[model samples]
Target chain A: MLELTKEPFFGFSLCMFSYIIGIKINQKTKSALANPMIIAAIIIIAVLAVFKIPLENFMIGADFVAMFLAPATAALAVSMYRQFDVIKKNWLPIVVGCVVGAVSAVVSIVVLCKFLNMPQDITASLVPKSITTAIASKLSEQLGGIVPITLAAVLVTGIFGAISSPYLIKLFKIDNPIASGLAIGASCHALGTSKAIEIGEIEGTLSGIAVGLCGLVTVFIAIFL
Target chain B: MKLFKKTLILFVVCFISDIIAYFLPFPFPGSVLAMIITFLLLLSGLVKVRQIEPVSDFLVKNMAFVFLPSTVSIVSYLDVFQSILWQFLLICIVTTFITFVCTAYSVKLTVYLINKRKEKTENA
Candidate 1:
């Protein structure tokens, strides 16, 4: 059984199998917290721990899966282009909103982390927490952060935005769909955008646009940070 | 064959972006450079939507699956997470709300100001 772990096929198949199960569980539970990535990661980690399989062995095949990261990040252009018209019309508010959102996210994380005496590395990871995973992970790598922690921070931020946006909207008296959607995407990325889509078509579309724009803004901001 | 062609195009673009990133002074990400290039290509009518659609859609939809291994790597650093779990959770909650509220209001204010200027100009 331990020998099987050496084969790249073993790791690849295990990853696919676990993720499919994760998706199935998500479908059954219908809970926002039942994120397929979280479920799949837990399952894979548990299996490796139980079997005493070295992470290095698992990584041999996992590298193949990670190859898609670059292409997928680039493919974000397709969706961004689709929102070009809305962005053109509301470029002022969108640009201002994303810049504000990205700055606040980084500033708040740094301030809070410093106040709590969290280490510098963890603070770096949390700086990119509000963006999508692909861009966030890369930014984390660039900032000398631990990628896994960055992933964890991004996942939590996204879930929080998805769950709290509606209540936050009411609390703040935010009436415009565009404003609401931009806020959600800037704070939560795609996860919150899913909820925004449920709220309204315009909200969803604008939220989607915010994800890409906010990511771009944060990338430039990170260079200075 | 078509899927292969589209995937190849994306990979080729990624390859070019990687080269471009290598020549830059700053530690820019090649993947992001690829994103910008792809966006420009699409916007300028150099790359049609349908050309990249099928493969791009698959990659985006199943994106989480691709990152599972990276997430699994967290198992190696369990100690870091265990020590900072509470602080981490607090930061996430606090910062998410702060960013959300700030973005929402700034956008609202900008729109309001734009409309006010529009009204003033109309009267003039």
Candidate 2:
């Protein structure tokens, strides 16, 4: 069984199978909390913990899926490129909105970490939490953060964004989809975009567009910090 | 066929961007550099959006899958995370709300001003 897991196909298949199960559960529950990714992660973690599977073996099968992150992120340009017209008309607001979101996330995390006396490495790991995993993971490596913690932070942030965005929008009395979408994408990344998509197409498009922008903005801002 | 080709294009673009970032002074992540380069290419009409739409859509739609391994791998760090879990959770939740509200309000205010400026111009 250990050798089987070490095989390249094993991890990939495990993730795919888990995702399918997650999807089925989500479909049946029809609950936002039943997110497929979270469910899949929960299931995979449970299995790995139960078997005490070597992290190395699991990674052998899993790294291939992780590789998709780079190209997929680069591909974000295509979707946002389609939104070029909307971007053109509201470039000022859009740019400012993304900047605001990125700055707020990074700054708050740093400040909170300091206030709590969190260790430096952990603080660094949390820096890119609000960005998508593709970029956040890379940034964490550069910033010398623990990749796992950074990944956890990014996932938790995404899930929280997806779950809470609607209520936040309502409480803030934000009526415009553009406003809501910009906020969601900036704060939540892809997960947030998924929720935005459920609410409206324009919101979805704007939210998706914000993911790359927030990533880029966070990257540059992180450089300065 | 089309999706495969588009995906190849994105891959090639990313590969080239990585090479470029490797040689640059203070390289931002290659993925981000690739995204910017790709955006520029699309803007100049060098590459049509339709050409990459299929692959882009696939990758973005299934993004959560690619991230699954990393998220699940967190179990390995259980000892480290166990103590700080509540604080991490609190920060994640609070900051998300802060960023969300700040962004929405900023966009709303900015757009409102832009519209107001347009109205003034029209009236004049």
Candidate 3:
């Protein structure tokens, strides 16, 4: 009777162990399909369910880790700061790409939701789904959306971005490093940037820049419009 | 010690952004606001990149792990949230591709035009 659920180490160790395993599996496979976040989430949930641990118990220590999301997001500035030269050269394309990317994501979601006769609450949640989960979840709350639904949508969107971005670039024969990275980050956020970083330095820098730019664009769009 | 200072700087910036967003009618996500504010500060040379380097690297590199608590939240919403699962999932997948395509094409177009303008100037 360890009462593992009551102890803080239980949740913290569970997540760390799962994520570390996730990274290793991803490296061995050399595929984005086995995303570490998805893998870790599934493993953690299974462990909790198998032991019948209440979510409240798991969230205690896990909550401290989650608080990093905000500062981590703001850290996009560090990436931008590092790549000031690239950003300075391609400012217009970056801005335009992110704005267009945000608009297209929101518009297409609205159109599809309405076409499918989806409910308004669900639509509100889905509207900002293209943004990073941290910002999207907050936007979802502000728009009277189901926060979890929005988080789920944002994750799925990111997964699509990560798995499909390389394919998308190849299918379209996109050669411009700036354009490719910008597009991936604009659409995919951090998940896509991981792939971009694999491709080259230019794409990595631009993609990192795109994550923050698109987040800002989507937030303003979600809040004001 | 240095990491603490960097975190404090970012924390202060994030707090100010949160306050600004709170006063607005539209509830903007404060962290994103902080991101923009920080970006500007960096751009203006107000905050040197070296100042936040250590903390930012740790935060960004391990960003995926930070999402653990939120992703685990899926368990709580399994009942009410998944009612429209098919539609929501369908829309998410389709729009993601569409947005990706549009973003890439738009960036391509802008770069193309910029290159064309450069070519024309060189010719002149």
Candidate 4:
């Protein structure tokens, strides 16, 4: 069994299987919280726990899935490129919004941490919560925060942003696709970008740009602050 | 040949940015440097936006899969989190709420400003 687990394909298969099941669960539940990733994680964890399988054994398979992050993040450039015209025309507002959103995200986390008297490490982890996980993880590690905590924070932030954005936009009567997409992407990252795509082509493109810019701006702020 | 050259340039830009980021003493990861470099390249028209589409699209599509490694790491740190689960939960919930509120308010404000400016210009 251990020997079987060591095969690279084993982990890849498990990850893919889990992801597929997660998607199915999401479709069945029709709830954002039932996200395929989250559902898959729970299923994988439960199975591992029940079978008394060590995490190390399971990770041998899961790492295969993680390797795709680089390519996926690179793919966002397509959306950015597609929206170049809109980006060029409203460069000033978008830049200002991203900067403000990124700074506010960090500042609010710090303020809350101070008020709650949370541990410094936790505070550090929370600082990069609004950025994408790839960037946030590195920032967390450098700041001496827990990477897992930051990952979890990023996941939750994205989910929240994705789910609530539509309602928020409706309530605020925000008609501009650029504004809508920027708000969601800056607050939630890729997850929000997914929902932004569903909202409309323009919103989707703008959201993609926001994700990249938010990640960039948050990185600088995370380092300095 | 031109397409290949442009692709090569894109890869070189990304690679060089990564290298520069590695040498930086900043606390954040090096990918941010790559992004900044990419943005600069785009801004300067040294690399047209169209050229980087293939690479960026690849990155965006598989974005969620990247978190699996870290999620797996959760198993190793189960003990640490178990002890501080409540704290972690609180931080996650509150920070998320704060982010949403701040982002929404900022968007609203910006929209208001744009509208005001438009009105003033029209009246003038």
Write down the lDDT that model 3 would get: 0.84
| All models, RMSD in angstroms | 1.1, 2.1, 2.6, 3.8
Q: What is each candidate's DockQ, to 2 decimals?
A: 0.88, 0.73, 0.68, 0.40
The CA lDDT of each predicted structure is: 0.92, 0.88, 0.84, 0.73
- Give the Cα error of residue A32 in candidate 4, in Å: 2.7
The DockQ-based CAPRI class assigned to model 1 is high
Q: Residue A58 of candidate 4: its Cα lDDT? A: 70
Once model 4 is optimally superposed onto the true structure by TM-score, how far is the C-alpha of residue A47 displaced, in angstroms? Answer: 4.3
TM-score of candidate 4 to 2 decimals: 0.81
Q: What's candidate 3's DockQ score?
A: 0.68
Clashes of each: 0, 0, 0, 20
Model 4 lDDT per residue over A111-225, tens place: 8789878788888888888887777887888888898888887887787678788988887777777778787888888888889999998688777777777887887776667
Query: Which ranges of candidate 3 are over 4 A from the true structure?
Result: A1-10, A24-30, B80-82
Q: State the TM-score, rounded to 2 decimals, of chain A in model 1.
A: 0.96
Pick by TM-score: which candidate is best?
1
Candidate 1 lDDT by residue in tens digits, B8-79:
989999999999999998888889999999999999999998998999989889989888999999988889
Name the top DockQ candidate: 1
Q: Residue A95 CA error for candidate 4 (Å)?
A: 1.8
* Clash pairs detected, candidate 2: none
lDDT of 1 by residue, A1-225 (tens): 677788889789889999999999999999988888889999999999888899999998888899889999999999999889899999999999999999998899999999999888999999999999989999999999999999988888888889899999999999998899999999999999999999999889989998998998899998888
